[model samples]
Target: MSAPLLLILIAALAFLATHVLYEWLAKRLLIVSGAEYLVLGVLLGPQVTGLFPPSAVAAFEPILVLGIGWMGISAGTSLRLPRLVRIPSVTYRLSLVESLTTFALVAAGATSALAYGFQASYAAVMLPALTLGAIAVASTPAGLDVAFGLSARAGARRAAPVLRQIEVAHGMDAFVSIFAFGILIAAAHTQVPLMMRALTTTEWVVVTLGIGVVGGALFHLFLGSERSPDRLFISLGGAVILTSGAASYLQLSPTLAAFVMGIVLANSLRQPAPVDDVLRSGERPLYYVLLMLAGAAWAPGSNVVWWLVIMHYVVLRTIAKLWGTGIVTWINRAQAEVGLDWGRALMGQGRLTFALALDYSRRGLPYGDLIFTCAAVSVLFTEFFAARFVRSAVDPLLVPLEQLSMTLSATTEAVMESVTETMAQRFPALRKVDPDAKEHEHKGKR
Candidate 1:
């Protein structure tokens, strides 16, 4: 898209962010994923309005990489291994059980189903399997105030143990899924140089890990001693760009490399909040772009009926999750610390799922579009039913949802500041009763 088109897109997004109907649909109805934009993107895509063609969608790939890298960094920073070890062993066990089972069942089912039924190449069959497997291991921690909404600290006190276990499990799941997805990107992806083509899959995987480790180390070295939030924001952006550029060139997962960089910085930084806050502040714009691209990629043809494959994909995931939860429940049947149908609590797939989805589209696989389409459908389906399903297992709990991106917050602040300064210059006396001074005076008066 040209600059004008980009501006129009931005204007439309700004409108959607504040629109009352969108508010009702997002906050009041759906479980709180940015999936509404994705569906909207699909509607305006080539399959529907043809406004966003494949070429137009491709134009946004660089931005897509940046967005995925941001998500990976967010995931990595969320974990502090020092604190992670403190969680009860039971949490790890349940998380592992559920994640592993879900991955095994869903991946195997998807691969087998596609191979037996669809007419795609081996790469196509394996691509979706790996993507789904990585995604399967993920669970969103959004709805809890400690997460996005579980704010009645005192009221939810009884659920504290529950919350901790779930959160730890969630972090672990994200870690594994991202790591595995990165590996899949390295191993199965086919964009190697002719000279490096002789290298084995194991070598590629090792290179992927190496990129992440080195990127992480370099990030810290470059960010040394910078404590200002503004500086941190700039450094973070630069790191994301560098790591993403390298990954894109190597045809590896940029998010995975950024994830490792985040982990390294996370462990090293005494004060990570400045950087984390800055990164998180920009999440909305990234998510909106990614969600739309993921949506716009779905122009399905008659080949094996893409919708049918998507349905099958969702069903397998649902069964795998439920079955995985059943196993966990049975294992913990004797323990009170464990909740029932823990998988239900984990039903929120959130951004990571979409992250992997969007990343898969970059691989140039034959059925890559189909994989992303399935993911968008899954995300939407999960977002719609997330809270409903959670209510079934835990009445006080809502499903995980990423809070809507505050895209306009910074712009709004800047505008307000500019207006205030302009007014202050116009009326010099107005500066005498500065808000800070007035607050101080009021406090003194009180």
Candidate 2:
């Protein structure tokens, strides 16, 4: 009956609706262009909606933070210990190298823009660069999902070395982005002595590893004797969400913690793990809200924002893509039999970029608006090329399957033709080759 109660109910529905809409739209647009959906969020957010008013948005902030934590914890759980130990040097090397490359390129552009008479302040220039750098550290799972799905549709088994390496690179990016943001946030606010102390790169990494170990260990002990069909995933999901939420509250990086959790669970847990279903359940909801929040808050149409967007999103992102892929070419040569031509498969900017931009905005970085604009643009452009590159890279693998299907179809047609011909030649005689006739012939010979 009260206006306050009515508003609360409406906001609840809005949150729920946003998630469902995001998932539905993601499926549809991913087929069209995944990057488009990123902007769609900006369209729905306050700058567009006038729906997510300051008060409404501020109220939702806590929930958004919680969602972020959930995402991080979930991500941490992806880092399997076995996978890490199995390829230690390559994993760490690729991640560090790529993160730095992306950071430098994006930062240089932002710095240049500032020098060229842009309105960005000193903090804005440095902060945006760091934010973009953090984004650069993220890999687009949506792009990967699209690529992998197309590969499967085309009947590919295990992905080629290039694709595999890209996936690993993405994982590394996610790991680095998490901690990088933590350090960035801490550094930006020198007054927060505690934040600075806790977020030293080393401390950030240790905390991440610690969270994973502790979370995974606790989950294992809790679920060791469980026999339910979905025990592995349910238990793991609970731990990830809890760990991520708790870490966020503590001002730690939930993304790193979640990633570490994922890694530990995959290695330490048994086969037929339940993580797939659990992850699926959480992913749709979290991603939907995340994008909407980013979109609703997006500020478009300013010339300064436009200029910044072009510099960072278009030029810098392009450089990063080319450079990142080129690095992959070398890494692939050193470690595997697969060769990746940077010209073909390097369009990978997705949710990770959005997340980093959001992280910076949340921290009051002056370049938040610019970062959002750039990230939204990058997602769009990358999605367009990602589908093409993925299809090209995966096409070769599908050719044999295509050939096999055609061969089988042709053989069947031939067999049917032969059967028809034989029937036409001896329809009546077919009945005459009888059991009694063979017996009679044998008796006569005897």
Candidate 3:
């Protein structure tokens, strides 16, 4: 077999192994970190073991693109209008405030690092910063999923509210980052005249939306009245793959296009439930592959300036999340208490961040390697610390299930007693029979 094919087989096995390990660890520890898989990937990657070389990784780019496009679709479906309406206004406000603040702060920090710190050219500084900022706005869903899972197991009274905020925040951030990245990509085409460039970007966006609407409609029609899981998976998967390929061929944003398609499908009144199930079923394995490839592609420089840039990106991003969430909550008395735990809860970054970085790198953005490495390092940091923070923030709010059980038991017993007393008062013969009458009668019969 060819070396690239061999590498692909190894990666698939590794991905499966990681999934099993994650499940086992999650069950035992109540928290399973994805950082371990990344570390494993690094160990087996070109920079270390030289098992999966640059050539091998390059060969896998198409697969990565498909995975990323699917991710965008998954995220798009998350923005179901009905669900969004059900979310609290505070959750929406927090998501927007925190995401935008993170974007602005990261962009500023990156631009400064490039221009003043590293002394790069004007175009380099602006373009890299814009892409970096767009990428930094995302938070991984893994940490939130684990936190909420544990909270539910512990019967946390406040879990519902926290879960809602995190869900809304994560979902909104995904859309924001993808959309911003698309716009940035469009804006980066400077070969044409200013007027033509603006028109071109607008046209790309419109075309992207059009692709989504038409693709989604087609998907719905193809599924027809069938509810078979196999059929749903095949049809939806085929549509997404076609969409991804078309976007790549057109040099447009596959992520944005897939996202738009997802939105269309999700909002369609006649959309089948199996469609969602199919997407979710395929998302996990694809996510694992995406992250592993991201790790394999990791290459860091020895420059102090780059290190400084990474640190600046990390620190400023944190401050942005806190500051944004703080100001929003402080201004709104209703969410004041929630803001206290918001920033820490949102610190986790994972697959989506890596995917965005990978996308940026594939686009040949300036300083793309540095951005990817920084993102990888930052994701590791957040994964470690964020889990602890989520636990800490949620632990205090937990209402143990034992307490709930006891309360329920007491209420049930009281209700039974009240019913028995009412029956006894209404039926004098019943009261005369007494609680032991049946026992006495059985003894006599024996």
Candidate 4:
């Protein structure tokens, strides 16, 4: 059997087992965004194993690239610009401030740490730090769902007045993170195509954006605002493949380009987006695939310098997250009641970090291993703290379950009573002609 093909069969089987194991692991945590898969991958990977070697794993890059590209597209589609325009301006300001500040603080600290403490060339120190900065900026958009159990339209949101602000920040923070990473690519390492060797950084950016627009147009033309569910999925897959393939050819970031395509579709498409439905339905397998790739690629750096950098990364990220978000929460405090420990609301890291790491760490860049390790470690730690941080956030807001149940019951009763009274007042004949209507409805429930 061919080496890469054999490796794939092994990973495919391991991935099935990982999915089952991950479901079991997820039960222990309040929120698990596939970090465990990375851990399992590490255990099964060449670093620890009887598993596929680095050469074989490297051969699998094409598949991982498309997966991460889809992630970028997925994030972009989440933004519906017309609707976001109506959210309070304060939210926009806060998301901007928080995202930028966190990026700046973490990037600066990480660079200083690596340049001074770790022994690496200029590129090695700068690149990973900057990647971490981008990873640090996006607070997971799902954080609210994890925190308030917002999945079912729970009442916790009514108690936490800052949810609108929290949500806007979460949704928009990825823009700042991804754009910063894209600029990093253009400025630091983007390759010169033979025909485009003289283009400046700004021109390079234009080229990448053009690629995204083209990809989106391809998707737009193919779907034409309508397609069956199955075809819609195929069309999106094809568009992402083409966009990512072009970016890969140019040594530009596929994630960034795919993101641009997603933005194009989200804003310009006039009908309900089947793109989202397809992505949602297919997201789990994507996560697992990336998880296996990330795990196999993960190699723990075995020196004090690397460990110190990891430690510095976690500390700096936490301080940056708290300090940046705290400052904004303070500013927003005067504007709204903001009833929870608002600083921690947006600290959870999600798939965007994984997506970026997958795009970067697989490229044989300087210290790519450490960057992937940091991304995994960062994700693992933040998810833990984010769930823990909910205690400080929701503890004060908690109501007794029985009491809440009674309150819901009373509210339902009061609403029904008001409706009946309004109907009787509007039509005196409703009571006279159908005197048993209310009684019959009540009795039917039994």
Best by TM-score: 3
Task: State the lDDT of candidate 3 residue by residue for 233-323, as single tens digits.
Answer: 7777788888876776666677888888898888883654667777867776776677677677777798988888898899998887766
Model 1 lDDT tens row, 42-148:
88677787777777767766777888888888888888878777776777777777778777877776777677677666666776776777877776554432223
Ranking by lDDT: 3, 4, 1, 2
Tell me each candidate's TM-score.
0.79, 0.71, 0.86, 0.82
Task: Give the alpha carbon lDDT tens digit for every residue of 278-389 in model 2.
Answer: 6655654555566665666666556764675466556775666666656754854543333344323445566556666665666566656667677776766665566566
Task: Identify the superior model by TM-score, candidate 1 or candidate 4.
Answer: 4
Error of 2 at 157 (Å): 2.1
On the 0 to 100 scale, the lDDT of residue 139 in model 3 is 84
Clashing residue pairs found in predicted model 3: none
Model 4 regions lying over 4 Å from their true place: 1-29, 119-124, 146-161, 190-193, 334-336, 384-446
What TM-score does structure 1 among the candidates reach? 0.79
Candidate 1 Cα errors over 4 Å, as ranges: 1-4, 11-30, 119-124, 145-159, 194-197, 302-305, 396-446
Q: Which consecutive 10 residues in model 4 have the weakest lDDT in total? A: 334-343
Candidate order (TM-score): 3, 4, 1, 2
Candidate 2 error regions (>4 Å):
1-45, 81-99, 115-124, 150-156, 189-209, 224-238, 327-344, 396-446
Q: Give residue 208's error in model 1 in angstroms.
A: 1.9
Q: TM-score of model 2 relative to the true fold?
A: 0.71
The CA root-mean-square deviation of candidate 3, after full C-alpha superposition on the true structure, stands at: 3.8
Tens digits of lDDT, candidate 4, 1-446: 35667557755755664466544533466554566667766766777873756665677777777788888888788788787777777668777887888888878877877887776566668877888788778766544554555344654443344666666666677888888788777766645656746667777677788999999987887785775889888878888889988987877778889999998898878874577878765555676667766787676768777777788777777776666666666766733344435557667776888888777776777667777777787777776456556546544544444478789999999999999989999998776555588789879998
